[model samples]
Target: MYSKFIINKDSFLGLAMNDIDKSSGNSLTTKYKNIVDSVLKEKFENNKYIDGSKIQSEWFPQVKCDIFLSHSHKDVKKAKQFAGWLKNKFGLEVFIDYNIWGNINDLLQNIDDTYCYDKLKGTYSYKKRNFTTSHVHMMLINALADMMDRTECLMFFETPNSIDLKKMTHSTESLTESPWIYNELFLSKILQNIQRRKKNELVKSQESVRLYADLNENFNPKYNVDISHLIDLSNDDLKNWLFHYKDNKHQNKPHSLDVLYNLKNINLK
Candidate 1:
């Protein structure tokens, strides 16, 4: 169970940023390299049926993450900056899927070249390609679901790249071209809602303060997304949450999320 926070462009950009350098790009690239290496190793290591359990374990290792950041592929830079801010101020470890998932195409290409490519045709077999894609996508979806289940919070960076504002004759709606973003948003809304686990009950040892799109090609399909269920989070709420966390001393150790949940929603009517 996790809480979803919707932070629009304005609210996100307004937050006071720490002096985090642009080194996130290098680190993100290196992290992605490691994942690609691991994937290649798993494929070449031994000849055994790659079962669901092995795929889950090999493809998605248990990373310590307090917030699962959901956003467009284009917003990776902004997401990294935001992640740095969260870490600097709150000691939160964020798992940005872009660090790995953004390079999914490369992974797919490697796999296809090895197994799905037809040498004579100089192209991949349509059916074989589909089979490989479905398996990889299924693994990705399952990993995402498992990560969301383990994390305490999810923050979606709302931006033009991630969502399109559609105005009909009588109503307005938010639509996303990327099925991945749509899936993340849909899961965030429906995933089990539970309170943050206490420190003693947590499997991972608490480090510190507990916590915590893109465009298109030709055949893009738009998904109608509803973000009303997500709690609206603003810059003011972030500042206030910091204060609330600093002041709370009644409990042995307060959950950082409790302070956020207790705050009034300024965006809700």
Candidate 2:
């Protein structure tokens, strides 16, 4: 189950929540180096809601994807409700983990305020450089990232089940954060973002660059909608740039048959 809390504190008795946000941001800014420590591995233990799926129909015919929803059990009910919505909306078959979200009666049984507050005060692990709270958080984020990359699984926003969605809907208060989906499509999110990417990354070959450059020169409208504007990049030039290791092959790079197009057109110069 997944949920998110978007706290937009309006003028409650004339004092606004923005004041607190600014103060906290300023405090963090004063000690900016922590950004590296904090940002290095985003310790977000929230569920991820993905609006898109890389799971093509051919991948699974008999089984709908098995999604591993990881989050605090306090967030389970809302996740189930949302899962219901998802099932109704896309006719998607889903499986909710029992550990994170049990029945409502179980929720009532486990609603200890003291337990909630004390959850973070657990033991530290020198190996992981984490205490209980941070360790759990890091684990969740890593799991979420891995799931998002899967061709089938999708993680969704996670929040406590204590949140009242029906009341929230009726009140006309839009969730500012509103619990959006997170994807690693952007370069920063995956390789550089995670503690991964550099070693096994596919490098852009100079041949690919030359190919793009050459294609740009020989591009014609019959081959495309707007030939000049569309295929303006030469594949050959792109390939040359991409071929990292210099060799005898590029010694006498032939001038393109179609006169060298103005680099200024594509702003390449």
Candidate 3:
């Protein structure tokens, strides 16, 4: 769920990233625009998140699940079918991203001959309603917050296995990988509060990262950070930082030097 990137404004390649265990940082979906890659695509194909069919999984805890699927319109149909299956089988509520947003010609890009508006409409012809800009963004942020606030990442295992793994594996160490069916998680109820509080904190960190990025561009600050340290931060602190970073507008909040001093004195651990 966490990723550290050294982007050169071109592609995901060319970066020496750190692991979460050694660094104090948060998860990575790469960026708003570039969210996919061959490595990630391969992970999805391999279904690494799912336990083998024979492996007994504990009941999915936290009753009253309301799945919120956030994705480009290109992914709406898949999300809807997935949502419908879960709802019918388990009676769990599902909110596919399409139902919220409306007229997404702007939000989703990179489509021309391979895809078009009329074709996209046909794709969703069976479904009703689309997502609006405000609705989609707000819901996505809300859903992500919910997942992070909870103990588990609202998981679902979709890809059904052709055979049971327990029978195939004679030893504990050689079990096959099973893919997790679900995607995205709902977040905190006090999201508005957390959002505002974090907005004020992130400007500083964003400035730091941007500065680091710029330095990389001009070759200046000689950046160096271990991902393990960032990952080692408690979920709470790291999430707080994430929410702050997300609300980039709040970067201008004026925290007095004394306030920072007081914060430094407080035991974060």
Error of 3 at 31 (Å): 31
TM-score per candidate: 0.78, 0.23, 0.22
Candidate 1 lDDT score at position 160? 92
Error of 2 at 35 (Å): 34
Candidate 1, lDDT over the whole model: 0.66
Q: What local lDDT score does residue 19 receive in model 2, on the 0 to 100 scale?
A: 39
**lDDT per residue, candidate 3, 1-269, as tens digits?**
11111111122122222343112111111121123223222222343331223112211223222333333344334444444443333333543334323222333222221222356455532121122222323333333343332221122222112112332234321121211111121111222222222232311111101110111245532211111111122334323433443444655643221122232243211
RMSD from true fold, candidate 2? 25.1
Query: What lDDT tens digits, residue by residue, belong to model 2 across residues 156-179?
Result: 332323122322434532121111
TM-score (C-alpha, index-matched) for candidate 3: 0.22
Best-to-worst TM-score order: 1, 2, 3
Worst 10 residues of 2 by lDDT: 205-214
Worst 10 residues of 1 by lDDT: 205-214
